[model samples]
Target: VAGDEDLPVNIDDLDADFDPKEYDRRMQQIFNDDYYQKGAEEDDVPEVSDEELQ
Candidate 1:
């Protein structure tokens, strides 16, 4: 469960001169992934009517 390949990079290890555009792009990707995951989880649940519960 602890493979080196699966390890996340440390922020302190990043270059001091990292491009601001690259950081923005990476942040956008993370947000997109989170939004997609939430949508996918929501799709798995079934919606029931109030009448059905009665």
Candidate 2:
């Protein structure tokens, strides 16, 4: 299971003075990481044609 360490940031740490740019960068990084991981997993799955299903 994913843990807090896997998260980009702790929600409990955010305050009124938090920097938006930093937060955005962290979120983007997380998104990119997840996208890349998903793409990698997809590569392992074999592709099938419509004819194979018929």
Candidate 3:
């Protein structure tokens, strides 16, 4: 949760108007970032030792 991605809503930004589209976009970005991070971690390959080749 950084910058506008912060879960806590700001009274100043929502003083009068609430944009559902903007909110959805921000949430989607957060989810995508998390999803990619998980994918990158899973893509890592473990090194095999030569001794294990027997």
Stretches > 4 Å off in candidate 3: 1-17, 36-54
lDDT value, residue 9 of candidate 2: 56
Each candidate structure's TM-score, on Cα atoms with residue i matched to residue i, is 0.33, 0.36, 0.31
lDDT tens per residue, model 3, 1-54: 354353544564457466888778755765676666866896998899999887
What ranking of all candidate models by lDDT puts the best one first? 2, 3, 1
Best by lDDT: 2
Clash counts for the predictions, in order: 0, 0, 0
Q: Which pairs clash (backbone N, Cα, C closer than 3 Å) in model 3?
A: none
Tens-digit lDDT track of model 2 for 1-54 = 254355555664465467888778766876686767866885897889999989
Q: What's the lDDT for all of these models?
A: 0.61, 0.67, 0.65
| Total clashes for model 3 | 0
The superposed Cα distance between candidate 3 and the true structure at residue 48, in angstroms, equals 22
Ranking by TM-score: 2, 1, 3
lDDT of 3 at 48: 92
